[model samples]
Target: MNWNQIEGNWKQFKGSAKAQWGDLTDNELTEAEGNRDKLVGKIQERYGIAQEEAERQVDSFAAGLKH
Candidate 1:
């Protein structure tokens, strides 16, 4: 989903976000403030992944929800 859809459903979507980025704490996700870039950065920082990989993971997660 796009950022608007993600932000609109932040509470519901956060669980999936946590599942995808298991290393990220709830506080980090909250601190991301509905910004995709910040969320990806947090995931990268917490999981030690490269920026491109983190973005890909987030994109993949979003794509999975389309099914």
Candidate 2:
């Protein structure tokens, strides 16, 4: 799925996001509010990963989603 679709259905995707990054709290995800950049930033912060890695992970996550 594309970012637009993901953003539009963020409520459903929250479960998948939580599964992918258990380190992230629900409030953090809610703060991200389906913003790709925000999610990437949160992931980077929580995982202590490079920005590029965060972007890669987010892209991969989006790619793996359906409908």
Candidate 3:
């Protein structure tokens, strides 16, 4: 799904995101507020990964969701 869809359905999809990144807190996810860039940045910060890797992971996660 596209970012718009993800944003709109964030409440449902947040669980999937948490599954993928267990270290992420609910508050951080709330702060991300379904924005792709914010999620990527939070993942990068929490996971200590490179921006590219974070983007790739987020892209993959987003792609796996059913619309």
Instruction: Give the Cα-based TM-score of candidate 3 against the true structure.
Output: 0.96
Task: For model 2, name the residue pairs that clash.
Answer: none
Give a tens-digit lDDT track for model 3, residues 1-67.
9999999989999999999999999999988989999999999999999999999999999889997
Q: What are the lDDT scores of the predictions, listed in order?
A: 0.83, 0.94, 0.95
Q: After TM-score superposition, what is the CA distance of residue 50 in candidate 1 from its true location, in Å?
A: 0.9
* All candidates: TM-score: 0.87, 0.96, 0.96
Candidate 2 lDDT tens digits, 1-67: 8888888999999999999999999999999989899999999999999999999999999999877
lDDT of 2: 0.94
- What candidate 1 gets wrong by more than 4 Å, as runs, is none
Give the TM-score ranking, best first: 3, 2, 1
List CA RMSD, all candidates. Answer: 1.7, 0.6, 0.6
lDDT of 2 at 30: 98
* Off by more than 4 A, model 2: none
